[model samples]
Target: MLYSDIADVFDRLEGTSSRLEMTSIFSDFFKGLDPGSLRKIVYLSQGRLHPDFYNAELGMADKLVLRAISFTAGVSESKMDELWKKEGDPGKIAETLMKNRKQASLFSEPLTLEKVLKNLTMIESAEGRDSQDKKMKLLSNLLMDSNPVEARYLCRIVTGRMRIGAGSMTILDALAEAFGTKEDRPDIERGFNITCDLGFVAETLAIGGVEAVKKMKVTVGNPIKVMLAERLPSISLIMDRMGGRCAMEFKYDGIRVQAHIDRDSVKLYSRRLEDMTSNFPDIAAELRKQCRAERAIIEGECVAIDKDGNMLPFQNVTHRRKKHGMDQAVEDYPVKIFMFDILSVDDEDMTLRPLGERRSKLNETFGLSDMIQLTTMEVVNSPEEGEDFFNRALGKKCEGIMAKSLSQESVYRAGSRGFLWIKYKKDYEEALTDSFDLVVVGAFHGRGKRAGKYGALLMAAFDDESGKYCTVCKLGTGFDDAFLAGMPDMLDEYLSETHPSTVDAEMIPDVWFLPTVILEVVAAEISLSPIHTAAKSIMKDNAGLGLRFPRFTGRVREDKGPEECTTVNEIISMFEMQAQNKA
Candidate 1:
């Protein structure tokens, strides 16, 4: 496949608003690609030389790119910088320079699809450690052979900002379109779940067509990203809608932990599935010391408190989560483990086991040990009985109750939240000025008394499906006059004219921002909205979601990334829990 052909498709996709049109364009585009090359093509479409998580980035920044563009367009560095400052985007800056060039005629040579594909392959093999002189020379050489418009996207691709908007969902939709069946999507997703490799899925799709996707099967112990959920505000909401009686348990206020134990060692995984073995050395050491069985995978919570037994907040425990300084951090904020459920035991992946059996096996295998304790739970038959336990939990400084379905057939759904496990908490029910950690994505230019600085800013929730930011709410409050006055200087470093991989929006502010800064926000309540892009139509038709009467929480959450901000799934869980309480 030619690079120009891919780029042309990208252009059309970016311009179109209709899903049907986008799918049609992609179906045609997928026809020309073979399996191995199709895999490569998907990655290239996102301007990534390789998959992001396991691989190191090419690490090309914008300044070096501007230099390359200047060389290509025959412009001075000073002139290019001015254009960059004005446009706030390298691609835009390049476009302006290209337009100003004396020899830039309407009859300039156009880029062919073959040449674009060839260059993309070449770039994948190019090492970032190559000398700047050599790198610039290579770029300049490529530029001399290409026209200005092609050079514009080429520069953006190398710098990791293609502005093509070819997100993960785009590829998923494209796969479904090319394969010509929505029924095959589950199988295709299973392929990704096992391999955790989109490139591999794309290749299979191209080679076997939809039949390749149909060949995907479930594989146990592949270490997929586990889907997690928040506790609902009330257990009554969970039970009122159920057919019969349900089982209930306690909801602990602690870090969720997934433990995988082999013969020699035990590893801990966070909800994000990032290995935290180094972060919780004490937990690993204790698991090895206490466990009688060799192979097991369990889930639990880790709570930190003082010798006086006062529960610490989530923030304090998070401070001790550094990869290095484990010993010191453990000393500062030692935690107690409360094991709840087991997923596997003795070489058997028991995730499909009923909650009752899993609990029994977990109880039989690992009882309470030092630093490891079982969660306190009661077998309640009614929502009223569960409510009493929920109240007792709050009185004891616990989060709330986790109402579980105790039937022998209840299985642990990895990466799903059905009625099997539900959390009921008072904090979620009582409309607080609920605090949210949101990402800053866009900013409106200040006016009048606030001239030369930002006034209101656009905030977003994390979209895990696409790994991007979707606008949830706009915040301009909770700032004292002094904080507001000094906002521009603090935020200027993060200013951009384009959103990164995880940010998507229909409305562009005066300035786009890299999803870097995380802010603490307080809102009266969350409500459905059509305007907000975060969780758009995720709840009901034509209804997106956002926080109502949201104000700044006066906390920046500077330690976190935009990706670490509260997610759309979390918000939806909270909403569902609230609805249950009303019922």
Candidate 2:
């Protein structure tokens, strides 16, 4: 298929508001494609050369991209930088200039999607040791004389920022629509749950139809990609839910990490499955030295507090993740790896096993030793015991408690933040809560101290039944100057003209956003509001729910997505729980 053909379909998809329309757009286009090719098309639509877990980077940075932009658009480096600073995209800037070129159409080339796919593979293959120039040259050579629109997408492809708003979940929704299987979302999700690759899911749908995906099975050590999540100011509602005793563990304030260890070496991955082996070398070394089992996949949180016991805040742990000064970072911010659950061990995948069995296996494999300390977890018979532990956690400056079900049937479900593992924090029950997970809808231009960065974020909640994101809050607090300065750059990937399928709002922000990123928000309290869009008419009158004093918490929930954002149902449930307690 030609780039123009796909681009036309893409434009149509982007222009539509209805999910049904979006579904039709993709279904028609993909039905003609080979199953495997259709999958590749899905990945490319998101502007990613490959899935994130594979660590397939194009390895081209800004300076090299600037060189290509300079050559393609006939602009100086200084001028290009000026445009990039304002627009946050070199490709868009190049597009603007290319349109003005007298011979722009003459430069255009009729390229095929196959060529694009091949180029993507080449880009991923070219990595490490001075490949930036080569990558830039390849991109420049592809679009040296191309038209403005072509140049725009070419730059987007190489830069790994499509800016077309075609995110992973969007593709998932599109696939579901095309195949006419919202009822089969779970089957598709099962395919994804096992494969962890949307490309594979798309391909499976194309090749075998829905039946091919229905027969998928989970395999161990294949490293199925996990979907990210959004954070929530979890409360001690488990006590209310079960009306029975629950197990509680301190919700450590730190980075959530998944450790993949084999007999040879241990690798650490972030919740997003990004290779973070370098981030926590100390933990890696300790895992190798201390882990008893030859092979194990354990999930834990790392805090850059103290080895002795003092837990640092999430911000302090984030410092350990800086790429530069590896040795000093480990020394400055010593982290403690609190192992919670073991997913696999010694070539045996244990996630499907009962929690009781998994726990015993974990305890047997990694004893209470120096390198791996068991996360503080206890089985209790009463809600008061769990509540007492919750207080103790907060008293020690901890986040809160995680109430886990100890049933043998309770297994480790990755990519799922279900009631099986509920978190109970201090402010969860409060009307005006500070922390919640919100999708980033829009950002404001910086001024004064924030002159060159994002000032505030427009955030929203998820309404699952409606499958739309609803505006619930706007955040402008709990972030330092440094964090504020970094917001725009960090969120550049998510910037869009509309919200994700996970978002439902009548009031659109200046910029739309992909639902890929999740954030932990701090707010004053929940309130009834007519202006906000979340849960409109669900409450008394048309005054739906909204957060009064929403702010960004120090926590960056890299583990979540907008779908996992505080649900309208959850909010109503919490409100009801609060009223019952007060009464």
Candidate 3:
């Protein structure tokens, strides 16, 4: 298949903001692809050469990409840089320059999908002396064959910015439409959830059909997408949602990790599926020494500790993520793994098992030690007991208690967030019990002391049922002068002239955004409003829930996607809870 064909689809995808339409375009494109090319196309559609967990980045910096654009378009670096400043997008600059190239090359080769992917792989693998030059040459060679439209996407792919607005869920929908029926989507999604690789799932479906995809199981070394939790404001509500009896575990304020152990080998992955083995060698060694199973996949939190073995804040653990000074940083900020749940044990896939059973196996298989220990948990049958446990967790310098359901059907739903597990944090007990993670939909211009920066941000919560981000509050507080000054540059890539189709807001701002940046916010309480779009008409006619006195928490929540932000239903639940308390 030609790269232009993919570029044509990309152009159509870029022109529209509707996920259904994007999925339809991808489905149609996938139908014409060969089995061998399906995996490559799936990755390329996401502007990636491999699955995200692989972490083999193209490593093409903007300067290097500019050099590639200049070399191919027969333009100087300064000219390209000026065009980039004006256009604000290197892809557009590449498109413009390629269309009006000063020199016509004698050699013209049609870019193939295989060739493009192979060259991208080469770019990712390039290293040592003159690697930047080698990467530029490889990208330039691809651009030399690509037409203007193709060059646009090629440049974005090399620079690691697709800006297509199509997420993994959309691609999964497209795959289901192209290869199988809606009934087969669960199987396809299960395959992806277990493997955490869409390209591998696409290729399997193309070759082996839905049954083979359904046969996918949790392997020892392959990292399964970790299950996520929803949040409620109160222990009573959480206990009520979980059928009264539930296991409330201490919610540690640290890095969420998934450890995969296969005999002598152990690998760690972050919640985002980034490989974290090298960063936590001490934990890896502990897992290998203590875990009794020959092969296992367990999920836990790695909390940094003080010299006296006291838990530290999440900010202290951030230093462990650095590539440099790993050994010294580990000594300075030692961490302990608090195992919570096990997903797999040997040949058995524990994900399908109930949470109670999984916890039992986790406790039975892993011995408790200073470095490796099970999370502090207690089985509670009432809200009072749960609240007590939550208080104890907070007293121990932990975040809060995770109220998990112990029902027979409470299996680990990988890559999903539901009420099977709910988080009740320390803030939930106060007027604002929880901080919301909202996506920025728009921004207001600064005034007076805040001049030359964004004064406030219009934030929204995701409405999963409608696939839209609905307005909930405007954030103006909790930002320092430095953060305000950097707001424009921070949000430059996501700035859009038109409101994104995925965002629904009644109040307009000075500038609109693409609903990409996520901010952590806290508020006094949720109340019904006449203007906000979140949970509109659910509690009252023409009214939606709104946050009162919302303020930023200085957390960007970069690890979370827009779809993973606080949802409309959660806001409604909080509003109703507040009303009940007043009554």
Instruction: Give the number of the best model, judged by TM-score.
Output: 3
TM-score of 2: 0.83
Task: State model 1's lDDT.
Answer: 0.69
Provide the global lDDT of candidate 2 against the true structure. 0.70
Q: Write model 2 residue lDDT over 184-208, tens digit each, in one string.
A: 7767866776456788888888777
* Tens-digit lDDT track of model 1 for 243-273: 3466666667777877877788877866544
Poorest 10 consecutive residues by lDDT, candidate 3:
425-434
For every candidate, C-alpha RMSD to the true structure in Å: 5.7, 4.2, 2.6
**Candidates sorted on lDDT, descending:** 3, 2, 1
Which prediction has the highest lDDT against the true structure?
A: 3
CA lDDT scores, all candidates in order: 0.69, 0.70, 0.86
Error of 3 at 391 (Å): 3.0
Q: Clashes per prediction?
A: 8, 26, 2
Ranking by TM-score: 3, 2, 1
**Residue 263 CA displacement from its true place in model 2, Å:** 3.1
